[model samples]
Target chain A: MNAILSDYFLPCLWASLASAGFGLIFNIHGRGLTICAFGAGLGWLVYLLALDAWGQDIFAAFLAAIVCGFYSEIMARLRRCPVTGYLLVALLPLVPGAGVYYAMQYCVQGENERFLTTLLHTFGMAAALSVGAMLVTSVLRALLPKFHRAIH
Target chain B: MNDDKLLALGAELGRRLMSSGAEIYRVEESVIRLLRAYGAEPQVFAVPSCLFISLSAPDEPAVMRMCRIPAHGTDIELLEQCNCLCRELCRNPIPVEEAFEQVTHLEDRCRKHNPAVVLFGYWMTTAFFALFFGGTLPDCLSAGLCGLAVGLCALFGTRITGSNIFFRTTVHAALVSAFAFLLLRAGVAQNLEAVTIGSLMVLVPGVALTNAMREIMAGDIFSGLNRTAEVILVATAIALGTALPLILGQYI
Candidate 1:
């Protein structure tokens, strides 16, 4: 119970609150706000679990982003809103903020090797996130017409 | 209404969606869809900074409208409302005059969240991010305080006329990092990196980068490139801004 609390539950809760807060800043209100928060929390949870299992940050981010993308598309369909309304905020926790800061810091200090390494890592993580999300969304979009026809 | 008025109305809707930070393709699609549903075939092109639309019908001459969209903050509520309006228009077509009224009303009252709620959001976002990044309790508290400063800067930054994007972002980031460094020096915060990064989340261009990738994937290469450039510029500004203060603090 304690392990679950410390490792999984608490972090997911914080991630949800943080994403929801950002949703508010972007003027997402009411039920949309709650749904965004829940999706963000789920994304973070998936990210943490993936990291623990795979021990690769980029892979974890990629997997988590896939989940987020799928969730956003499904929710957008159900809620009758745009996918971006959910995807943007839910993907915030994995944005590589620290990497950007450290890369810049290294660049300023004239540590070219470290700066290059950090910059590449940050960009790679971002690419992974985008690619993962794009994979799901593109596939879904391609299949959407058939899916709609079937439903009708 | 005449074709000219309808064209203008369509362009205005496109303008609102673009200014609210909707994707270029989404704006173009919405505008084209809305116009087609109302019995006009329209050609629409949209980018981050401008929109071009031309409308024509069986018996009417082509009517064109061009609008230059100013940069604005992202407001998901407005985007959702606009999307809903589009869906409604498609299903149950409204009169052109009534559609104009709806679009104008949305334009006027698009921003829904109040100042206080927005400030609280900033605070909570920073605080919880600190926690998410493995900060201790004190770290979260200090980050929250820093977030208050960031919130204030964002609130007042928009009011300052002639303040360009690069200058505003650089200043805001520099100040936030400098304040974080001071708290560290004063022994008030244990983890400087966590606190600074948490507070800095507010300035990161996550939305721009994500949208850029999506646009590219969706094959809107022009808009994807435009948004990618924007993300790079904003990221560089933030990195430069945060680095300056850290370098200065190191010297001290």
Candidate 2:
């Protein structure tokens, strides 16, 4: 239980609060703020789980982004608003801020090889996130109506 | 059909959507759909900086309107209102005049948070991100202070940073890095990296990156590439800004 709390619950709580703060920066209000917070927590949780299973941060980010994308789409459809806010805010925790920082540090220190590696890794993480979210968005946009009609 | 009024309404809607940081596809589709509802077949082309709409009504010559969108931040509240208004207008075609008035007043109707609340948000984000990145308590506090400085600069120091996006981001990143250095030297923060990275989160171009990918996926290759270049420029600005203070700190 302690391990679960420390490794999972605590991190998710922090991610949720951080995402809530960013949501405020983006001028999200009301229930949408709460939704972004929870979605962020959920995305982080998925990332952690996928990391443990795959041992690849890029793959983990991709999976987590897919989840965030679906959550944002469903919420947007229900709320009758654009999905941009939710997806953008909720995905904040997974963005490669650390990678960008470390790359800058390495470059400043004149460690060319390390900086190059970190830069490439950062690009990979970013590309994975975008592709994951875009994949879900495109697939859902093309197929959700068909599924809805079938259900009806 | 009053071609001028219809053209005005479509152009206004597109401008509002673009200024609210809507994806290029969303802006184009919304304008096209709204004009279609009014029995006009319209063509829309949107880049990050400008939107162009052209159409010909029956018994009328082709008319076009081009609106240049200014630099904008993400305003989800305004985006939601504009989207909702567009949907309503499309579903039940309102008078072109009334729709135009509503589009123009959308900004007034939005409920923006007070400056104080936004500052609090900045503080909260940095403090929590410091903790999230495994910083100690003192580091978190220092990061919060740095966040406040950044928030102040961003909100009220527009004159200093100017309108250039790259220069503005560089100024913000430099503020965060310099504050981190000061706090570390004063022994208020334990880790320079943790505090700086925490506060630096605000300047990252995650929104532009995400929107770029979405636009690319939606087949607006040109707009996507435009935003992607922005992301690279801002990232480069951040690196330069961060390195400046740290390199100077070494000599001091």
Each candidate's iRMS in angstroms? Answer: 1.9, 2.2
Model 2 C-alpha lDDT per residue in residues B107-184, reported as the tens digit of each score: 998989999989989998898888888888999999999999999999999987899999999999988999999999
Candidate fnat values, all:
0.85, 0.76
- Model 2's i-RMS, to one decimal, reads 2.2
- Which segments of candidate 2 are over 4 A away from where they belong? A145-152
Where is model 2 chain A poorest over a 10-residue stretch in terms of lDDT?
A143-152
Which pairs, if any, clash in model 2?
none
CAPRI quality of model 1:
medium
DockQ of 1: 0.71
